[model samples]
Target: MPTVAQIEQALFQLAPKDLAFDWDNVGHLEGSPDQEVQRVLVALDVTENVVSEAEKLGCQLIVSHHPLMNVRWHQAEMQTLRPDRYLGRLLRRLVKADISVISMHTNLDIAPGGVNDALAEALRIEDPGPMPGDETGLCRVGRLRNPVKLSDFAGEVCKALHANGVRYAGDRPVEYIAVGGGACGDEIDAVIAAGCDTFVTSDLTYHQFLDAAPKGINLIDAGHFPTEDPVCAKIVAYLEKEFPQLIIIKSTSHKEVIQYFVEGE
Candidate 1:
């Protein structure tokens, strides 16, 4: 069985710590580095439900996309860990269960076959390449295999991502496209400048949709979890290949936490 540190090292080869943003948290966040691992649970987020699932599956470690500790918790003043709060409660559960955690955040988003690449592939973007003028390289640009009405393309995105629903804007067809996995509404300007007629991302503000139609860009606001969750499977496959002796399972209990409803439903 590999130690926690060894598994982390293997993960780093997939998405290095140096690739993470300075402000973001990545790598092993908790538990003993030397602890041996046989079963690992992979998840998009380390929620209470995910932790419980890890315990039930007899997992010795959890690999997640988002950090167990929020970036806000990295501040010096926030060092005092309280068991009463939400984050505290989750941390307590992990500590008690002896489950080690490793996270790949911004680094995963920026890696070659990471979040954005998976999103582009999910949406069927052809010949995908890096978004032009994006210094962070957090987004991808490409042409759709065939042009379709914005409404039609949005349906495809929903189906591809298993999204509960999608909100979109713009009257034009979707052809050239750009994709950023989560909370990338701010990249619309770059999308337009890169000559992409469609942008697929999540966590858009109301104003972004209002402004998109006039700019001649189709904007699809897929839910945040849907946009990023696909990468969990990618991580699972990578780990399974790298550590053939270990048992790797993607958390079946984890899914989009938010529920959507239609007016007539």
Candidate 2:
């Protein structure tokens, strides 16, 4: 059984925690280096639900995409209820319960065979190239073997990734696609640079879509939660192989971020 310190060292090789932005909190928000973890879980967000799920699954550590403390934190102890309205509050609860946390954000973005490339593969892309953004290179581009209409291709991204909903811009046949996982509204440049007929990612704002519309790029916004949720299982699988004795569990909160309901006539 690998100790927490040993496991953390291994993770740094996979996705270096120092690679996280100076302002971004990325590594070891809670727990101690000396602590021994018997079980762990992974999730996109470290919400209250996530902590509860970890407890339910008997996990002492949780590796999440979003950091529990993204800003400068005063203390690690949870005295009064943290009114910050951030993931810190949840982190406090987990800390009290001795649950460790590590967030893989930007480091995961640039990691080879990581989220961007994995998403591109899920989209049925061939020879999906490196990340294309000058800043925060999470966007990946490549060609689809068979061309499909904007709507059809967007639907495929949604369906294949088990996405609840997706938003798009433009209306023609889409051949090339640029993909990024989790809130890629800022990947417009990658779309234009690659001259892709379509771009698929999560979280496209109205302003973002409008900006891309003039460029004549078909942008598909697969919901953030759905697009990145599938990777948690992969994380667990990776860690399980490394630490065979430690239990690696997946999150149970498998619901769409947006609750969509259309009234039947």
Q: Which tens-of-lDDT digit does each residue in 95-185 have in candidate 1?
A: 9999999999999999999999999988889989899999888999999777898999999999999999999999998899999999888
lDDT of 2 by residue, 17-124 (tens): 766667667667678877788988888888888888888887888888776665454344334456484444775677788888877776776576667776876778
RMSD of 2: 3.0
For model 2, the superposed segments whose C-alpha errors exceed 4 Å read: 72-89, 132-135, 262-265
Best by lDDT: 1
Compute the lDDT for candidate 1: 0.91
Q: What is the TM-score (0 to 1) of candidate 1?
A: 0.96
Highest TM-score: give the candidate number.
1
Candidate 1, residue 235: Cα displacement in angstroms equals 0.3
Clashing pairs in 1: none
